[model samples]
Target chain A: MLCFINGEIKNINEGSIGLKDLALQRGYGVFDYARTFNRKLFHFEDHLERFRRSAKELRLDLNYTNAQITENAETLLKGSDLKNPALRLILTGGYIYSPSGNFNPNFIMIAEELPTYPEENYTHGVKLLTYEYQRELPHVKSINYLNDIRLDPLRREKNVFDILYYFQNGITECPRNNFFVFINDVLITPKDFLLHGVTRKVVLEMANKYWKVEERKLELAELNSADEAFITSTTKSIMPVTVIDDKKIGNGTVGMKTQKLIKLFNDYVLQFSR
Target chain B: MLCFINGEIKNINEGSIGLKDLALQRGYGVFDYARTFNRKLFHFEDHLERFRRSAKELRLDLNYTNAQITENAETLLKGSDLKNPALRLILTGGYIYSPSGNFNPNFIMIAEELPTYPEENYTHGVKLLTYEYQRELPHVKSINYLNDIRLDPLRREKNVFDILYYFQNGITECPRNNFFVFINDVLITPKDFLLHGVTRKVVLEMANKYWKVEERKLELAELNSADEAFITSTTKSIMPVTVIDDKKIGNGTVGMKTQKLIKLFNDYVLQFSR
Candidate 1:
């Protein structure tokens, strides 16, 4: 993979960073990722906006202007050999703790070959297990991921690819993906228990365009009996969830609504930047 | 400051990282910092034990042995010019995410000169405010620090150093310290809602040995009516809480028990270490 650190392109094999990025020190970071389609970056503006919001929430001052980050991302994408690349953007600590707001923010953009999701993984579906932990700061997209990292081992042990997190009240999200369930033809999702994912947002927009959607506090009971279920993320796109906690969902396969929403989502992203 | 990464000693001024260290890429990390007294690390073993626990909780495997980490820490400490230094230990994501029960880990550790804490601020007492966010994986000490990062910006805008956090129940902890309150000669603290800090642990041991101690959920009511209050941490050691949420704690100065605990805490660290 090719990576960009502070405006310079470097091979992932080479080490990068300076002493100042506390994201390396204290895990202070804010990042976002998206993919490109048809020679155009999908939801670049939306992702960057979220990235900026995350930085604002974390108080990590980025000296690089928004225009600069966007330009750099585009430049790095062009510099890479990837035609249909998955793009990642990362910003780390630059001294917000120094009593002065000055920070030399670490901006890294990496481009890699797009992943080919096994069609069945989304069609026949993947099984998921629920975790006991919840995101501490779900409203802002911050970089501290210990909650998810802590569960990754268990997921691996269980041979599950992802996790469904249940807080005291309801289901929140997957480690990196936002969760959704089809409840009686009305799509329902747990509100405020997740990062308000960009892809989830796209799904919501599509829902508004084609289906009834409800964003509220979702109870575990609702999820246990949902007609269908799926997860959304920039990378995963939309993948149907077949089993949660060993329970079959939606005839043990991807549902019709999910497939329809996937088409709507693709249309949304393809037209978003172009 | 001296740091070791990829098995080499490097100055903090030249601190850099590899792309694989997801502490930068994805904020996957676990770390702990313990101090040195007279060239010997205080609670070094405890710190390592907790570090391992933190990693285990986060499911990040540390490929290195405790003995190896200790040796690296010692080497880094010896290279640093500052004799009375505060140590910094960090572990980040390796190139691969291993999920099996056994995954060879990639992590790093560094020891740095203890930065000077403004002693006068503690003497005069510092002002702290409550934050909405709390640590999700309070046990593992992961690299994802978005909550702390977000609270920091507001703290900066308010010009405060520490951000006290309170969950829905009551007060939890400051961003980097644990809390204590003395009410009606009964020393007490918030339970489960705060990090079980080393200094806090030492204080509790000393208090149980010499005074009335209570460990349970603490409501804001108890703090408001407290006779005295204080906080503990490796950095702060022990500092009395003269004021909390604009209310005077005890005589609005260091409490008598706080004074006693402070004296005992130093001896505890020294005696416990050797």
Candidate 2:
């Protein structure tokens, strides 16, 4: 895979960053990723907007403008052979701070093989584990996933696909995905203190047209009692959540609403590509 | 400076990591750094123990054992030209997860110049800015300084050396330093939901000999009214904190207790190095 790092395109294997890059040294960076369908970026502009916002929030100075990044991504995508790819925009706080105590932000646009989940996961849905931890600075997409990574063993042990985070405040979000649930025909997703994912935004818009879309605080008990549940992400799209912890949602099978939303999301993607 | 990546020692400038490294991609990594005084590591074993515990808590499979890392540090220090330097041990979650979903941890031991703070920062003391952000995993020392780095502008604008973190629960700690306060000759520091800093541990042991050391919840009001306050870290040692936010700490001059502790810490360091 070809990656654009510091205005130069290099092979994925050759894509190396200075060990002193703030992203690695302090995890001081922001990133946003968007997947490609039929070799075209899905909601490219929306993702870039969020990417720029994340950098701004973290006070990261991007070497390249959003327009330049988009143009570079287009060029890189044209030469890429992967039918579906995930393009990630990374902006680091830079190498060693200069004498002036300023950072030279390092920007990189890399393409990776789009992760392919099992067909059974989409058909039969996936189980989720519950964790009582809230991400720090949930609004910004910073490179801090220690809590999520530490929970990997528990995730594997529980045979779950992802973990849902809910603190005393309320249900926040998943490690990498935006969570939502359907209760009595009302589609609810957490309103604040969470990343406003592009997919979640699109899902909200789509669901609003057909269902009662509400953005508010959702508790674990409300989630367990949800008629149907699902998570949205660039890669996961709208995948159903059949079980959370030991509690089964509805009848332990994918509900009609979840299936309908998944189909609707797929159709929306097709329309987006066109 | 010569550094060690895995087993190979390379020039610090030439040392680099793949973009796919989990440390950069997902911030899945653990790191511990200790400063060398007069070409000798101060509290080497303590830092390593904390480093190992951090890696274990995060489930990071370090490529090298603690003994191997110590040996590499010694070798790297031998080849180094600097007198006083900081050695940082970084263990990343490694390359992309395999098909079976496993990470090959990447280990790197790098040396950098020790940060030289103004002499007045110790004698006249340093001012601190207070932030209301709590770290995600306070126990594990992950490469997540997003909250700290984000406060750089505020730190500079306020002309403070570092930012102190306080939540609804009370004063937690500083971004990089462990906070302490002296109330009526009793030394108190936050006991839980904070990193067990190596310097803090050593300071606690040393302070226990001369003063009453109590590890408990430290309220902001108590800190504001403290007789004297200080912060402990690998690099900062026992630097005095004269001002927090807009409140002046005990007449805003280095207190006798703080000075004595600093002297005690320096004397201990000299003895350790000998």
Candidate 3:
């Protein structure tokens, strides 16, 4: 696979970062991932906007403009032969010490095959484990998934898809996805302490036309009364969450409303791809 | 300078990790740093123990044993001519997808010139700004310093040495050091929700002989009544903190007790190096 590293396109194996790069030294970097459909980048502008925001929040000197990054990503996607390429853009704090104050940021873009989950995860709904934790700097899409990746073994042992993080009795989000629940015929999601996912934004816009949408602080206790629940991400789109911590959500099956939203999101993606 | 990567020793510039390595990809890595005194590693066993704990906390498979890592560090230090070298040991989660579960961990040891702070910082004592934040997995020394690095501009603008993190009115720690304060002539530091630094452990042991040491939750409001304050780390050792958020600590000078502790720690280091 071809990857873009500091203005050069090369093989992914040859795309190595120096040990001094803060991305490795201090994990001081921000990244955003988006997927392509039929060789077309899906919601590239929104992803780019978030990427720029994340970089600015970290004070990373993202020298390249959005247009330049988009062009480079296009070049990378065109150079790759993957059916559905997933583009990961990383902006790192540069390799200089603080006193000198000269930071030359390293920008990296990797084109890889879009990872696919089990089809049953979307068809019959997936299960998630509940974890009582909150991410630091929740708004920025920084490359800090230490807590999330550390639970891989427990997640594998429990046979769950992902972990749902809740803090102080309030539900927040998953590691890589934004969570939504339907309660008493109202579509709702947590309003704060999570990355504002692009797919979640699209789902809100689409669902507002068909159902009542409420974005507010969602309580963990409210999940028991939820009529339906699902998660949204660029990779998964809309995956129904039928179980949380072995507890059944809406009869432990994919709810009708979740299926409808999935269809709507799929239609929107198809239109955007065209 | 030479660095130890996996099992081979190579030049520092040639030590590069693949883009897929989770240290860069997901910030899934842990590291511990130790410095040498008189060309001898100071308190190396304690640092290695903490490093192992951190790696286990992150579930990073550190393939090398402590003895093996120590031998490698000695080799790197012997190969380099730099006096008082700083050794940074990083254990990454490796470059492989999780499903197949074949994680070939990458252990990297980089030897560099020991970073030096301004001499006046120690003499006149340093100032720190207080920020209402808490680190995730505070016990694990993971490669997640995004928040700390992001505050570089603010710290430079305010001309403070570092940021003191407090959570819900309780003092936690500094970004890379352990915080301690002397309140009413009693030495105290936060007990929980922070990395247990090796220097902190040694300081507590030594302080017990001189002053009444209390390891409990230190409140942020207690700083106002603090007679003295200081931070401990591998690099800074026992540097005094005379001001926090522009508030004067005691008479805004390095306290007599801090100076005494500093002398004691230096003497201990001298003995260890011999």
TM-score, one value per model: 0.88, 0.95, 0.96
Candidate 3 local lDDT, residue B153: 86
DockQ (0 to 1) for model 2: 0.62
Over B122-223, each residue of candidate 1 has an lDDT whose tens digit, in order, gives: 676666666655576665556555566555557767766577777775778887788888888888887785568887777788899878898888776676
Residues B1-274, model 2: lDDT tens digits: 8889989999988999998898898888889998898788888888888888898887667756668888889888878777687898898889867523777888888987787888998988888987787787888899988887777778788888888898885899998899999999999999988898988998899899989999998877787569888898888888998988878899999999989888988898888787
In terms of lDDT, the poorest run of 10 residues in model 3 chain B is B96-105
Judged by DockQ, which candidate is best? 3
Query: What tier of docking accuracy does candidate 3 attain?
Result: medium
Per-candidate Cα lDDT values, in order, are 0.75, 0.85, 0.90
Between candidates 1 and 3, the DockQ winner: 3
Per-residue lDDT of A79-120 in model 1, one digit per residue for the tens?
A: 778868878777777643564555567777787676667878
In order, what are the TM-scores of chain A for the candidates?
A: 0.90, 0.95, 0.97
User: Candidate 1, residue B37: CA error in Å?
Assistant: 3.1
* Clash pairs, model 1 backbone: A144-B144, A144-B145, A145-B144, B85-B114, B86-B114
Model 3: fraction of the reference interface contacts it also forms = 0.78
True contacts kept of 2: 0.71
Docking class of 2: medium
Question: What fraction of the correct interface contacts does each predicted structure contain?
Answer: 0.73, 0.71, 0.78
What overall lDDT, based on C-alpha atoms, would model 1 receive against the true structure? 0.75
